[model samples]
Target: MATKPKSPHQEQPKTAPPADEGRFRDDTDVAVDAIHQRIVGREQTEPEEGFEPPPVWVWAASVVLLFVMGFYLGRYSGSWSTVAHEVESPAAAAAGPVKRTVNGTVVFTGVCQTCHQADGNGVAGQYPPLAGSEWVTRDAATPIRIVLYGLEGPITVKQTAFNNKMTPFHDKLTDDEIAAVVTHIRSSWRNSASAVTAEEVADLRAKYGVRGSWSAAELSAERSAR
Candidate 1:
């Protein structure tokens, strides 16, 4: 019996198409559609080159306006440097003996005590003794002038030439406080002069018209003429 026809020994040739052919066509079509959409979107979003930027003059004017406004506002608000530098009031015009003995006392406590000593006998040669000094004991004008205007270059006190500078107390002290301090100083150190009044100081300031210190020569001339 012929064995059932011998099954074909050789393998049959593959009959099936590539498994991904339809999938590849579908993916390619989707990619093309996506590319078309992107091109359309970009065209809609981008502005044309013919659209010009704002004018240079407009920008420049805007900047200038801003700066001017800033300057004006700063000035009006008292924030400007020039306003700060301008003096509000003269320091010598405020506060005096009646209003501020404590402050006056404190000022002397720190500085005058050093040279004048606790008893007001100033250091010899290096510092002129304030005790019984003619300038200290003289009219209140002398000491007031000295305090308001600093002494400098060279000065003669008590028959000795004192070539040292004394810093002006005008800016550092109020008028009343200066008067108080001068009053305290004069009366304290072996001195018996009258109290320096703020009114007197105001008059002196008006008369001298000096914003700075006075030298002994200038003082002497004023004295001799008087």
Candidate 2:
């Protein structure tokens, strides 16, 4: 069939759609939905925080600190009674009384050794010697009186005269301490004498009460009277 010829400038009609347009739209929608699903899943299933235990070293350090504090308080807290809140223990009561004995040599070395010297030899014309002194070894009561009251003025010892003051130990020493030192001097340095007792010192102290230093003549009179 012969037909009229078309013009050269005639436009063609649209028929089939553009290639891969539907497929590209579907793929873009699927990619967007997958990303949204991933974000929402992460938000819904998030993990919760929980409590955790302290480190081993921290616990160990705490225990050590408590122990050190306890030990320090126990060691430097004065008496056990104070630590026990002033409560007395039955064990201590059952232990009975404690007796204390003074050492004469210790007392002499501490108190008398400076004046009489370690060897009992006195300074010449100053302090009198205690070694082999008739005033010390002859009579027990004389030394006791001398120690309790003290001696002054001129005194003869070992045939030598000394004009000096002997300080009294009545206030400085106890009866037991005075007795011990006197007994030590009597027995030491080749002199054999009887021991002086605390009872004797106490008796003399009670009899005489308190007095001044004694002179040699007074001591001699006292001995003669005795």
Candidate 3:
């Protein structure tokens, strides 16, 4: 038997493709394989790189700041000496009593000047002159004892008589002040006299615990005997 050739107007038999077991398709017959493929229209962004170390300029600025701070400290730091010359001390230290080694010129003005007058010249016939007075310039004991205790009755200093009783200062002043006043008066006047030391005053005060006023007879009796 002979087979006849198909006509161009007749359609071929259509069969569905093999189905994807886990997927479904749309209402229109779109293939599941096409829907599962990578999308084509959207813009995809790549991830940025991980964290980086700080830039060079930041490190350089920190180094420059440290150098400036170090320079400033070295310039103004008292030549790096620990003397602390400007430290303020107590009022007693400034006054010269607590320091002990301090000079007596301040004590003379603060304590002795009232009675001895500012000029070392006492009132005529009332207080005796400290200037050129033999009692002060001759013997160390004369003025030291007199000032420590006081002087009573008539006393002749530089031939000027003072009958008024002078008050004692042992209770009023410290050993340092007494010594300073003695040193100041000795050097301050026109009279040439040796300086009295703080140690000397301490020794004398120890010998004479507490005593009453001194009489001219008592002071003059033992001149240069001390």
| Candidate with maximal TM-score | 2
- Which wins on lDDT, candidate 1 or candidate 2? 2
Collision pairs in model 2: none
Residues 1-226, model 3: lDDT tens digits: 2344344323333334457555565655444333333233122233334345578899999999999989999987888888876755787566875433756778778877787898899888778888878877886767888888998998777666679898888888777788777877777757668887767777878988898998999888757355
Assess each prediction's global lDDT (C-alpha) against the native.
0.71, 0.84, 0.74
Q: Judging by lDDT against the true structure, name the best candidate.
A: 2
lDDT tens digits, residue span 1-226, model 2:
2443444333333233467666544788767655655544313333444345668999999999999999999996775554445556898779876579999999999999999999998788889999989999998999999998999998878878899999999999999999999999999999799999999999999989989999999999999998
Question: What TM-score, over all chains together, does every model reach?
Answer: 0.51, 0.60, 0.58
Q: Which runs in model 1 stand beyond 4 Å of their true positions?
A: 1-103
- Tell me the spans in candidate 3 whose CA falls farther than 4 Å from its real position: 1-55, 63-100
TM-score of 3: 0.58
Candidate 2 Cα deviation (angstroms), residue 70: 16
lDDT: worst 10-residue window of model 2: 8-17
lDDT of 1 at 11: 29
